[model samples]
Target: MAKKKALTNVELCKGCRLCVGACPVGAIEALMQVNKKGYEIIRVDEDKCIGCGNCYTMCPDYVFSIEEV
Candidate 1:
């Protein structure tokens, strides 16, 4: 299998909430409050994510990415 790039780096996020709408699986969830950049950080809910890479494309900050199987 190929290695997968984990969707991390909430610090770099701007909390535009663009990725949330793009994810079909609803795997991404808003974290505690907001980051230093004033954007609501998100985390991948492994069970819901299908590795569709939808959020990956929507994220302008390149916050999201696909991972290996």
Candidate 2:
């Protein structure tokens, strides 16, 4: 069986940081970089993510997508 991971859509992110706090494993982190919309984006550590979908459920911008790796 393949492992699952979370992917991020940088363009859709509004830098709300809800997902950051919602992540159970601290896999998500805020970057100094900003998207085209001038909102700060987040990066996901695929190795640390457990596919719990916490970030997906918490984010209002729908930034996270889960897939098998």
Candidate 3:
């Protein structure tokens, strides 16, 4: 098994879709739905993340990060 990071802000996310495209492993998916403020959100697949931090850099909502545990 490989080390995996935790992603959040499913509802608060702005859904820029950068993270989805930024994922080198092609692990991210952009969903179509409004948040509390009517902004789009992103969902990540745990099985696909390679802890590459590509999504973390492209995200404006601060939704993804790696835990060094």
On lDDT, the candidate that comes out on top is 2
lDDT of 2 at 7: 91
Candidate lDDT (C-alpha), each: 0.76, 0.93, 0.75
The alpha-carbon root-mean-square deviation between model 3 and the true structure, to one decimal in Å, is 2.2
Model 2 Cα lDDT, one tens digit per residue, 1-69:
878888989999999999999998999999999999999999999889998899999999989998888
TM-score of 2: 0.94
Runs in model 1 deviating more than 4 A are 1-6
Model 2 ranges off by over 4 Å: none
Candidate 1: minimum summed lDDT over ten consecutive residues — where?
A: 1-10
- lDDT tens digits, residues 1-69, model 3? 657675676765776787877888878877776789888777778787778787878778787777543
Model 1 residue pairs with clashes: 4-67, 4-68
Winner by TM-score: 2
Candidate 1 C-alpha lDDT tens digits along 1-69 = 563434667888887788788877777877778888777788888767777778888888987667786
How would you order the candidates by lDDT, starting with the best?
A: 2, 1, 3
TM-score of 3: 0.78
